[model samples]
Structure formats: C-alpha cells, structure tokens
Target: MKGIIGKKIGMTSVFDPGGKQIACTIIEAGPCVVTQVKTEATDGYNALQIAYGDKKEKHTIAAEKNHFVKANTAAKKFVKEFRNYSEEKNIGDTITVDIFAEGEKVDVVGITKGKGFQGVVKRHGFSGVGEGSHGQHDRQRAPGSIGGSSYPSRVFKGMRMAGRMGTDRVKVKGLKIVKVFADKNYILVSGSVPGHNGSIVLIQK
Candidate 1:
C-alpha cells in the first residue's frame, strides 16, 4: 500500500460536479520530504521514511535533528515510514497530495477521542432496568440479573460491562477521495475519520 501522513484540518461541505453537497474531511497532506530509504540488505526491510512540518529548533531533540541533517532538511514535527513499494525512490524526494486524485479510495488510520469511564448506557448501550416503580429505588441504570441464583459460579468471560471507552487506534476503510487540491497540499475525504482536528492520520491507497 502507498501511504502518506496528513493532519486533519477540519470538516467542510463542498459541491460536487452534479451540484450535490458532499460532507468531507479536509486534511493538509504532504509536501513531505523523504528522510531515509531503508533497504532489505541493511535494515532487513524496505521502507521510505518521510518527514513533514517545521519544528522549532530550540524544542527539537538531538536525535531528530540528526535525522534532518541526514536528509539535508529542517526539523519536522512528523516523521513516518511507508513500506513495501513496487517502485524505488531516493532520499530527499518529496511526495505531495498530487499522488491522489479525485474520486479515488483511501484508508485512514488514527486514534479516536477519549471518553473516559463510561456507563453501560453510553458504552454498551444497555437499557439499564428503567424506573423504580417495581420497588426498585436505587437500581435505575443497572445491568439487571447478570446471572441466575445457582447456575454458573462466575460471570461470563466475554460479558460486556461499563468501564473505559474510546482513546483507541481506529481505522476506517474505503473512504472515497472526494477532492484533491494539489496546490494547497490538501485532500478532501468523505465520511468521518478517527481522531480530532490537527491529529495525525495515516492514509493508504
């Protein structure tokens, strides 16, 4: 798969050629410079590490600074690798949003927003035992009757319960490429993708 690193700018609505309004996620992608090219002989794998975004030199670390020096470029805030390509490329090569065209399909991977310590009502979508009309006072939102009185000795292993939620790596597949603005280094993808605005996302074609 051919992959690129992008930042989610925000969501916007654009009119298609047929005058239909399309909801799209705008991503500022690319103008990424290749930092290193790993070969099977040296690294036991083939990959190209691309770097993008300028970072403040005062806040940059020594190791990352060395990476930029090797590529003869400024320090970037993001660096990612794309592996196993059919074609060969060299270091310092730039890959922009121009690689993707309108109406193409791509897969996006990112971390979802965190919703900490959710209940069964929001987490697992449980009905939670309703009102207290049947002499049930405090048990308004409870997963009633987890098991019987004298049946299994313990709860089921894969039973759904309320605990932590969200803040996980998620991938949405087959998102249509609604539009591509190469000059602006932006691409519009249809449907919701994981993560919040300015979050880094991996796009694969």
Candidate 2:
C-alpha cells in the first residue's frame, strides 16, 4: 500500500531505548507531489495520485489548473489516491518522510475532532441514567430507553442514539514509527493521531 500525506505536528515525549517515555505524534510527512499516474490499461486500477498542502493559485480551478499542470506541481492542498501503489510512481514524483522508517508500522488516516453536539456522556461512553438521589433529577446524562413499547415500534437502526459526535473518518491502526525526521520532514508518530492540532493525516503503509 505505501502512503504519505501528513500535517499533525503536535505531541512529543521521546526517550525510549530502555529509558521509556515515548508519546510521539509530530507528523508533517511527505514532500508529496506525484499528481497522477493511474494506468492499468488506462485507469482501470493502479493508483498513486498524491499531492499535499501548498495550494492557492487564486484558489485554483480550471480543471484544478489543468490538474496541477500535468504534475509540474504547485497548487496542492491534499489530493490522495494510493491504490496498489508500491512504488513505481512518476509524474513529478517526490513522496517523502523517507518513505517512513524508524520502527515502521504506520496506518493513520484521520478526521476525528469536531465534537460539535456531543451527548450520551461525551458522545458514547454513556454511564448516564442512574445516580443522583432516588429521584433521579435530570436522569443523570439521559439517553435512556430510546424506543420500544410496540415491538420494533421505531428507533433501531444502529441505535447508538446521541446525534453527531466527532468529525468521523477515523482509522488509526497499528501506529508505531517513533521518530524519523529525514532532515525535518518530521515523522515521530507512536500514539494519539486523529485530527486536531493541524489536522490532515494519512500515513498508511
């Protein structure tokens, strides 16, 4: 799979090697900018479209300014793809963070940090409905019994109640690569990685 397209740049701690501290998360990744290269007898499969940050050719338009001028690279701002791409990229190729190293184990897609209208005790840890004198004033955090007084009467479709929580799209599997600056393209990653401080992440592998 192989991937790259980051921005997080926040947490920190380091110290491992028997010292034990670890924490990580810094990101930044990619010198990215491959721009196209699809092919599989002409776009039937094989991906690799890359692109990252640096966007503003008057907000860019005209077919994305002729699709980044056939990869000559300029107006970016994230444009992922990467399918079946295990190297063999072309069309202004770049891909950085030294393609990942340190200890390996990537996989971080992101977008989870909106928390707009949360409920059910911080969006889903629940633990509400009980406590607070025998009277149960506000019924604690309420989310109690959504529906049911007539056999499938309603409310039962992935029924986790409580409306919109985070921005969704999370992925975060594995994670470990604690450090790999590549002369400051940054990398760090080892713990928390959803979106928040600087957002935009991908990092697959």
- Among these predictions, the greatest lDDT belongs to 1
Write down the lDDT that model 1 would get.
0.88
Q: Show model 1 residue runs off by greater than 4 Å.
A: 145-158
**Clashing pairs counted in every model:** 0, 0
lDDT string for model 1 (1-205, tens) is 6778999999998887799998899999888888999999999999888888889999999998898898889999988888885456677778889788888899999999889998888888898898979888877788776666577867887788888999899999999998898889999999889999999999988
Could you give candidate 2's per-residue lDDT for residues 9-53 as a string of tens digits? 789888987999888889888788898888889989899889988
For candidate 2, the per-residue lDDT at 26 reads 93
Q: What lDDT score goes with residue 124 in model 1?
A: 86
Backbone clashes in candidate 2 total: 0
C-alpha TM-score for every candidate = 0.89, 0.36
